[model samples]
Target: MSNSKLFILDDDRKTRDLLLAFLTYQGYDTTIVDNDVGFFDAPSPPPRTLITDLPTLLARMPNILKTGADNDLVVIAYDKAESARILPQDERWLFMPKPLNLDELESMVMRAQEYHALSSRNPDPPADEYPHFLCSTIIGKSRQMLHLFEMIEKVAESSATVLIQGESGTGKELAARAIHQLSGRSNRNFVPINCAAIPEDLLESELFGHVKGSFTGAYANRAGRFEIADKGTLFLDEIGDMKANLQVKLLRVLQTKEFEPVGSTRSQKVDVRIIAATNKNLEEQVANRDFREDLYYRLSVIPITMPPLRERREDIPLLISHFLGQFNRDKRRLVKGFSRESLEILCNYSWPGNVRELENLVERMVTIKESGFITPDDLPEKYLPTPSLAPSAPAGVSLPEPTGIEELPAAGICLNSAVDAFESRLIQLALARTGGNKKEAAALLNLKRTTLIEKLKKKNLQAS
Candidate 1:
């Protein structure tokens, strides 16, 4: 009764009759293909399942699995001998020996129907939706993430400096690597240095290289990150932590594209693209006179802000699946997936540490559980939802009395307008309660930060 059709191309009259009669009785719109050539010229909408002999299937593979053809097409090939050796390694294919069993054939058909139904309802996104570099890393499908991908692609086409700002563990470094990988200089080196991790005294030497006898410990000439990253990208992680003296030196390099090694008067010129990342707000640091204002402007030529995981909770499932598969392969475990209840808990919980935290949790669970679905009981206590102790109305807040139907005017009112007013009032109250902090207000209202921002823009409402 479903819109799934079947095509049979067995050639022999008896085999074709049996297949057609059986499939038709099973509620399929069945067609009998007289020859391999007729199968190609059969119809407009291709058959959902194709039952054919091994010879005919192999002869028409180019037509059956042609580019732009229906990817959900299932092929059931049968032959006298074992044909698994000749069949393609596609999951949509199945092989059966000549003396076909009707029950098994029915089971295979039912499975193909189920696969078609599932795929039709929620098909996997096209591989080309995001850049190939981003496919393996920086996994996300949220609106914010998609927009971020577009920005990274655009930025990669140029050689301008990029500033990636986000909270810790939000994958700023991954974004930098993606930009570098997509750029023309990807074939060259992608040098990275953590400014905060290195000592202040030797940070300059590490960046600009050092000549032999430049300092007590300098035994031989060494190339810095800038020299090594020539014609490529240099990712300066935690750029905000760089000291004031280093900030001036870095600013000079950005302005001139040149720097002198430690204890060397000769200047070295290099074509290195700079990509800086920081967990701290550089604008605030500029105001505090902690970071150089000129350097901040120079580095933020192409600014990118990565949203926290809480703001894009829809991506939690995808991230979980990716990490699950990754850890499963690396640890040689067979952890199936998280239970529905456990997954709901994870999606709703506030991930303060972002993607890295989720990845770690998945890895830990996969390692411990080994080969089963992760249940709520298997999760850490912090990840579990706790009972709220606060009353519906918190201590300093007052709730407005509910309006009764009797208060309605005789002329009645617009339901949508009333709903909009109520929603706007709640948003205002949440903003006031959080002291204009949009992130906290979003949490208080049980909304994503981006969703809250969109609502504010739609309603043209300001913080109370």
Candidate 2:
């Protein structure tokens, strides 16, 4: 019925039937073969794509891979966890985790088709030129997202510093992890530090390590982030908040690729790629003498700014569906995904807190909702199309106060003003609750500390 053929072999009958139906609907000429029922010896024609479980594939992994290459087939190997061991390193092979996501499977299928198309046009393109940028967590079909993926693919092999700028919760650290994962140093540790979360006084020791008795509470000779990230990537998140003195030292590291541990004169050399991120206006900070201009230049060798969630509205549905499937798996629940109306409302709402906020909201819904598809009625009041109370929140869970929402003047209030007023009040409350500790305040608000700091700077209330 279709131009492409796929073969699936699984011991579980349910899985086998599900794959058959799903792939068939996706326009594939699909067939199911049992591993114990002469599956390997079947006289069926070679399929262009093969999806198989770990044990069955493992039994004859080497032979299967060789046959696929000979027959010009691509293999999608998946299992709970063990399938990873037998996965081929060959170009024609792809890997999937247990409880495979349909969206990711579809993406892999598209890549397989692309491979066939490209191989016909050119017998061989470089192996790395293939679509290895198919991480399930990095879900998006928007142009900007595709562009970001392309950038990651291009720069992954290089050792240049990468600076990712974005509003907090837009997934800056996720991008950094993507870059590191696609790079040659993926096997090494990916060390990350929130520059804004740490105190300015102790930041030096955190970055450069310290000798025993280097300062107060320096109990032992320890390695710093730079040393730990050697042969890997060091993600300095919220780098804009780094102290001026540390900026100078960081610039020196970029220039010479070496640094001395605190209280020690001996210099230590390490090969580490730097990936810095910030939610602040680093350029403005430089102009204001609050940040070092030289360090800014050094870190921004290849700057990548993450697009806000609102800007990439096309990605919202995909992300929502992904988080839904994830939560369903986490809770072992059969909760259906969002209703069409709920999806529209979610798509229309401005995600000021970005992806993290949406993800948090989804987790809450999946945990709290008892039955029925996630309808618009299930969403919080602020997110609703009309102001209405949601179901009673769980015990001990404090919902945001709806104070002043009920009453309105005859002409009604500007929605923007109302929302901002409410947000400001919540932020101040959280700040006070945490005793002015921005890190704790951010955690209490389920926000990144840098985001909280930016809000403070915006309100000119840093002194408060």
Candidate 3:
């Protein structure tokens, strides 16, 4: 592989060194020079690309922007109080934030390389599509999520009935709202009713309007969600839980765009868009004769399925940052963010509750934890004490274990380098013992499965 030449200017040696090490590991010919007024004076081979913080870049803007006009440049700026007051508006420039989100960095590097090859356009995102209106308030740019956004955008342009499916807490309601907000009827009201939340007896009246004395308790004229949602969208949540008899009535509305109010013979005309969501498998419900097949087809003119959180792990960090900012404002707290170790614990967890669960956890953590970064220690009990890297001997089997490092040169050793080497070796041994079954290997090593996978990547090893 051909390595890209990179130049970095940052007075902070620790940050510079970390970037240097990471870029070097990624096969980049990287060099760091003193970040001062005369930054362009670095020797023989001049930099073709540059990476620097906002303060340093602003102090040297004229020359740097001049140089950037001819070469690719990346600006890492801080947000909030110490933020770059005004972001650069040049297409040639790609702006990102720091102290650093490694995923964002990696994506930036890959896209920059593609840009240099003239095969890709700048990958810098717009100021924002802003916050998503989707359920659980979707936040991500992972391939899976990007595709979902595309699907939502396309479906929103029309009046097609929608059926959203996913596991509980997967944001089905959010998706429904997103579709409505993006549609032509955005200015109109969006009515949402939970099929499962309402009593079966009241659901029919709740959906289709009721005139006076429709049933035993219908004392006043009432507009149902469908009528209330006329000229807009009606969200039917937990739609799979809707009874078969009600499903027939729903199908009639879908077919004629009209329905009669209870206790009234006159049919009322309606122009409402339908967006239905459910956590249960509607197809299974149909097979079990619990749901009507004809109604299912009518309601599902367009189907959208949301993948669970575990499938889109890349979004974890972005979600982390987003939630931190979100709760900070809503709860009026000043919790900074997560410590690296705490972030690792979060990313490794299999979020069975999906984005909703993650959001709730962040809110809880920020609320209870004191002002400052959320560290491994500050994390809840279940997340603390990352799994051990060393495996224990089986109950009946005994094996000789390494005692300690015996050899040391006259010069004192680097403890971190030594620990990394030891950890890498033990991980390999554990993997071999488990026949490359990562879950089993993680168990053998007493590590969380996600923790082990990350270690495997850092060690340049393949994981099962």
Candidate 4:
């Protein structure tokens, strides 16, 4: 096997020398540099990882990153404090607190080397799509989501108004924001106003500007969501919840690009691209005379419907990882990720609340839920489903056990055995998905770290 090289940067000569000797003894081609500048200017060492102390390391990272190392390059930061501060934690970066446990350090260094070797042996991510749009915020690879992304790319350049329709908590707002970001108006503001959140009396004033003495509490002339979003995108959320009177005014503005303030006679005009979203059925509301027909047509110019979370079950694991990383930043919980069984439950559960529900569930698991691998029971009662829908006994029906293991009756699998098998399979899958990070797996499973470990033990499973 080709030798792996490691570099050390530190202010203290003694510490740098010690690490250099230790790494050399571990069968590595090691180099010691006295300052960050020297480290940056060092001759391009064949694909190597770097280890250093934190004090000056972080201060000079931007420059070091500029002298880009091959993807094989990893960074490890060390400190003596009990809670070593690790900032901007990149996947290639590892952190260890000192008085360093030599064994753990060795294991970490070896693991980094192994990972680099494995990655180098695999195909690289496509260069053209390296920085995909909203790829960092929204994670999914299902055909449905891919098509949605394609549609977003198609509409990003045009100045067309977009209407995102979906069930509540399905991330309609996120979709709207994504559209704006990918469009030409990205540099401008994305003003969002929830029609259902504000009172009917204040909804009109909120959408359109109010002159100084327009209404009872209108003391000073105020710009509404439209004015603030001028030359930008205005997101009208819960548009279906707007009263009939407000709908007329909104429709007028869409058609005429002008509207009078609540109590002002002079009309105002603003070049704002309207992107409305709603969980309610505007067509039904229109049929029932609760919503205006003209308004519906105008708003539906570029309708983009977001699939409910349950409909796109394939995206659950990705969403779980995304949310876990978000919450784990502050929790400092060692919980690696989710166990398989927990993720199965999350995916199978009918997420009536959609993406919003899933996010809330993950947050609860990180903050107040049980620890270890998140188990089925750690989830909220609502997430478990009714007895009829439970994986063990479907529709309150029970199956007979196999007699003397005759042919191992496939139709008559025992509930305990079935659940166990399901959990075992899930754990294996989660581990494969996250490359064996228990905390990340737990997040994907929406389970606490401790609970995931317990479930793994019970199921007699080990992460690869």
Candidate 1 structure quality by residue, lDDT tens digits, 1-464: 34778888776899899989998887888888776655555565643788888474675575557764667688888863545665657757776655777755765665566446545654435534864237379888888888787777666866778899999999999999999999999999999999999999989999999999989989999999999999999999999999999999998998789999999999999999999999999989987999987788678756799999988989999999999999999999999999999999999777878999999999999999999899999999778765322223323333332343335545556656666666776777676554466888899889999999999999887753
Candidate 3 lDDT tens digits, 343-430: 8777766666789898999999989974798888776765443343443332333222345546554555665666666677678767
Q: TM-score for all predictions?
A: 0.59, 0.57, 0.57, 0.55
lDDT for model 3, please: 0.72
Model 2, span 1-464: residue lDDT tens: 22456778777788888888888887877787655355545566444677877475565767855675336577777863565566546657776666766655765665565445434443433444444234545767777777777767656766768889999798899899989999999999999999989999888999999999989899999999999999999999999888878888998998789999999999999899999999998889977999886677667656788998877888888898888888889987777889999998888766768899999999989988844699887888767543222323333433346453355545555665556656676776665544355776798789998888898787555413
Pairs with steric clashes in candidate 3 = 134-174, 135-174, 135-175
Q: Give the TM-score of candidate 3.
A: 0.57
Better of 3 and 4 by lDDT: 3
lDDT of each: 0.81, 0.76, 0.72, 0.72
Q: Which consecutive 10 residues in model 1 have the weakest lDDT in total? A: 387-396
Off by over 4 Å in 2: 1-134, 386-464
Alpha-carbon shift of residue 149 in model 2 (angstroms): 0.8
Best by lDDT: 1
Candidate rank order under lDDT = 1, 2, 3, 4
